[model samples]
Target chain A: MKEGNFCCHKTTERSEKEYKSLMNRLSRIEGQIRGIKGMVERNVYCTDILIQVAAVNAALNSFNKELLAEHIRNCVVRDIREGKDETIEELVVILQKLMK
Target chain B: MKEGNFCCHKTTERSEKEYKSLMNRLSRIEGQIRGIKGMVERNVYCTDILIQVAAVNAALNSFNKELLAEHIRNCVVRDIREGKDETIEELVVILQKLMK
Candidate 1:
């Protein structure tokens, strides 16, 4: 909600802890990308770089799991309880995307 | 080492479990990305989409951590024990990149 921390749209306000957690993960990922770039720049064996690439991909999956769980727990469930049936439809569409 | 699973360079051979694990994570990420794309297609709320975007980013970080740990255990450490000092330098550059 703050000026500089507009990491997400204002549809839902994340708790301070949630926002920090998300930011922390992103910062680490930025570092990882820089590391990958460095490997390429330095020509550290091609296979070596590939290994890191695979690792980064896996990290991404874990991230999705964490936030998706949080979304279901905090946002979607509450919206549905408050009689927002459209949110359920929206969630279903999202699940379809994830399962694809 | 197989023909179809050229997920990484031939620098290291992942065990069956490791390879499967990496592949599984990637498959899930592919699904997650597709889900995000679906949100865009449906014209979902911007904030909702942003939350998912943030989630994907975090997942990527986790993927990197898993693969990195495995790389150190199987590749870098082994290379060092086998008297390849260059690998140490390579790993240090990698570490510096990650810590950046």
Candidate 2:
């Protein structure tokens, strides 16, 4: 990690492709939320809106899962190999939070 | 249900307060998402971003639960009272999706 790019608290430098993918996922999720807001505003059927909400939730979950996998593969693995055992505890804590 | 406001498929007219409350919840969720996107752009730590994503997921779940409660209390119950039994099926299907 660079000066401004700490592994955990500081930051992580993602490849351009990684950055783009994460941003794209977030952008799509954001747009979905906006669309749901529009549905609510237009007084759409409750079930219809609920179904859309489920879709957004799924998209968010997908984003979380993908990011978590990458984090484990890169950051967690590198930290462990470097004998940064605290990273394991940090990973455990976040896993608990994400599960909740 | 009014002409343009069918109970399920057509639409359901929500009270002004109901509308406002739902919109407020959605707006907050939308803002939370935007904040997450900012974190990604700033190259925040992966675990940190994952935690924020979890929070957003919880917020979305809260919104879904609230909306579902209102739908049951109003639309589902009313339809049942009116002998429109199909509403029950619709409710069941949406519940399955939400849980999924």
Leading candidate by TM-score: 2
B1-100 per-residue lDDT for model 1 (tens digits): 2222544433455577866666566556556666765554444444466567666655655766777788788778888899987877877777766654
Residue B35's lDDT in candidate 2? 96
Interface RMSD of each: 9.4, 1.4
What does the TM-score come to for chain B in model 2?
0.88
lDDT of 2 by residue, B17-99 (tens): 98999999889999999998899889888988998889889988998998999999999999999999999999998888877
Each candidate: fraction of true contacts kept? Answer: 0.08, 0.94
Sorted into a CAPRI-style docking class, model 2 comes out as medium
Residue runs of model 1 more than 4 Å from their true location after superposition: A1-100, B1-10
Note the chain A TM-score of all models in turn. 0.83, 0.89
Error of 1 at A16 (Å): 34
